[model samples]
Target: MPPTRVGAMRRRGLFVSGAIQRMRHGPAPGRWILLIGVSLVLGVALRWCGLPAGFLLGPMIAAIALSVAGGAVAVPRVPFQLSQAVIGCLIARTITLPILTEIGAQWPVFLGGVFSVIAVSLIIGWLLTKWQVLPGPTAIWGVSPGAAVAMTLMSSAYGADARLVAFMQYTRVVIVASAASILAAVLAPSADGGGAGSWWPSSVAGRGGTLLVVAVGFVVARLLRTPAGPLLAAIVIAALAQDLLGLKLELPLPLLAVSFAFVGWGIGMRFTRSTLSHAVRALPAVIASILILVLVCGGIAVLLVVFAGVAPLTAYLATSPGGADTVAIIASSTHVDVAYIMAMQLARFFAVMLTGPFLARMLTRWSGYHAADRA
Candidate 1:
């Protein structure tokens, strides 16, 4: 046991400990760092390309490509979709009763004082089952054309398939939104603004209000656990408030559109790649459900022209059963009765959300359907 032997043992022990530590930690543990770097580079590239006005249709197509290329992400269902109803109804300050009340006045002029349009919706809804087009409740919700999120919630509650309902609605949105410009271009009378609608809640919030609302919305959205819905709601609401006051915010359109894209990405990521893959196989059924909806709602619009004495074009946009933002924009640009269109649309949205679930439960004949998960 000499000093030289003791030094040799100590050196061996040090080597052993170092080797074990290296084994535990491994190399390149910062995977997310690399992902962030790549995402950042992509973002900058996108911003710099200078996409032409109303050129978002291309970018959206690109995003879909990226999501598919990135591969399917599998995980438990996320929580935020459930919160969309709450976020839609309450997060935005502009969804006030005053605006809604004013919008309601047009229902008489459009739906008839006897609620003929809604009655039509109900009858059309029943026929969907007759045609084997959709689950009864979902058909009703699909044809409803109200608030998409609200309808989703109602379907969830009444025991319809929330995911299917959401997927169907989202599909229709993509279809209408994707084709909006094309349709407008084809259908627009040259003298009538060429079917290019004005941005609704036309007042853009100035720098100060925009920043303030963005900050407040970010904080509240984080706190409320409504990741995307609240933030988007903030943009919509604050801008709306500014418009109502006649001092609109003047933020650049590109910035707002980008914000919307990010929000959409977050929501799109919720259903793991697998959920969407399954949805892909079921695309025919999903597409069928939405087609039925478009037909029924479109028919309702045509009938309103006859029964309520509203113009066919005006009622067509009003009853188009598309997204609130999309329809709102159409109404504003076309100089349609924005108030009435929004009122009926919003009510339908809420109706779909709150009541869709129970109605789904009432349909007991479906083979794979359920009452609780509602999806």
Candidate 2:
């Protein structure tokens, strides 16, 4: 062979050897770089397209694709925990004094709405479990109307399949967000055009305080070693500090993006070929259950309108089953009672967080009993 041909052949052999080595030893650091790059591109695209939780969803989808294709890469434990803590803080920051005051003024109405939505979700989850649509408490967690990311993280702690739960949760988020946006447009067409605020923190002290809170939460979670401990701890600490101490919690856009990417990658990289196949098969049942929950919540909204005398649009948005962030966006743009809507959303969120584990255990026991009876 000519010198040029020999060099080309040698280069090709080296490439093949490297490929084989990577397969045996798992992906290289370059795989991580590639994953991050792809995740960023997709995240930005999805966000531009107006998908709720697009950044997280984009990374998750990218990770799933890579994992299923055998390019599996795992997020580091520390980063994942910190990301969870950041997400917890994000949730806590939503609970402002205005939202709390709204809930306080009509505690009964808020209580009714919260429990009503929770009860409906439980019923739908139970039906899915009884029908054997998904395994164990996965269906229950999947159908829970809490914040999608929070539910997905907490579900893993309860021994449910996080991959499946993530799938179900995000699917519902997309549907609910889209439906809510459409309804808002139709019902309140005149009320549009609220722009997003700045993504950067206004003051260094606020950012530092928020980081300090996250650190404390990280330590507490490390000591507790509970499932999703970081997330739960951060939420409690940040919420109390914000609501009671009048401290401002600030999370810059870059910090949030990184944290969301970490979470998205962590969950996504865990998906195996079997898991992906299982999720595909379960999609129909999941969609049906989500729709049922949405419809039931709509009925609850009607009750709010008739009895509580909330505006029709506000009631609908407030009683939305999932996608609190998306609902907030719509509520902000529209001429709805934003405070009341957020209050109801936050109320349902806290209620789910408190009762989720108990409900999971109950569902597990009930599933076992039902299975035994059938056997």
Model 2, stretches more than 4 Å misplaced?
1-28, 91-94, 129-142, 147-202, 243-246, 279-281, 302-375
**Per-residue lDDT over 1-375 for candidate 2, one digit per residue giving the tens place of the 0 to 100 score:** 899999999999999778645653465586776688789898777566554455666787788777777778767999888977876776677667776676688889888988999988888887777777787778989988866767888887776778898878766775786687567656865321222223787988878889988999999999987656777788779989988887788877677778777877876776667666769888889888888889999999999999999899889988998655445545654566766786688678778888988987797677663434422
lDDT of 1 by residue, 1-375 (tens): 999999999999999767534532333333223323334454445334322112233333433433444432221223223222222222233444565665466545544422433455455555564454555456555554445555666565554556666666666665655444344334432222212322343444444565556555555666665323453555455646654764334334344344333333333333344435646655776666556656666677777788777666556666666665555433433434555565566555545455545544443344334344233
Cα lDDT, model 2, residue 167: 78
Q: Report residue 267 deviation for candidate 1 (angstroms).
A: 6.3
Which window of 10 residues has the lowest lDDT sum in candidate 2?
189-198
Per-residue lDDT of 355 in model 1: 53
In order, candidate lDDTs are 0.48, 0.75
Off by over 4 Å in 1: 1-56, 70-104, 110-163, 188-205, 214-246, 263-273, 306-313, 329-337, 364-375
Q: How many clashes would you count in candidate 2?
A: 0
Please report how far candidate 2 places residue 112 from its true position, in Å. Answer: 1.7
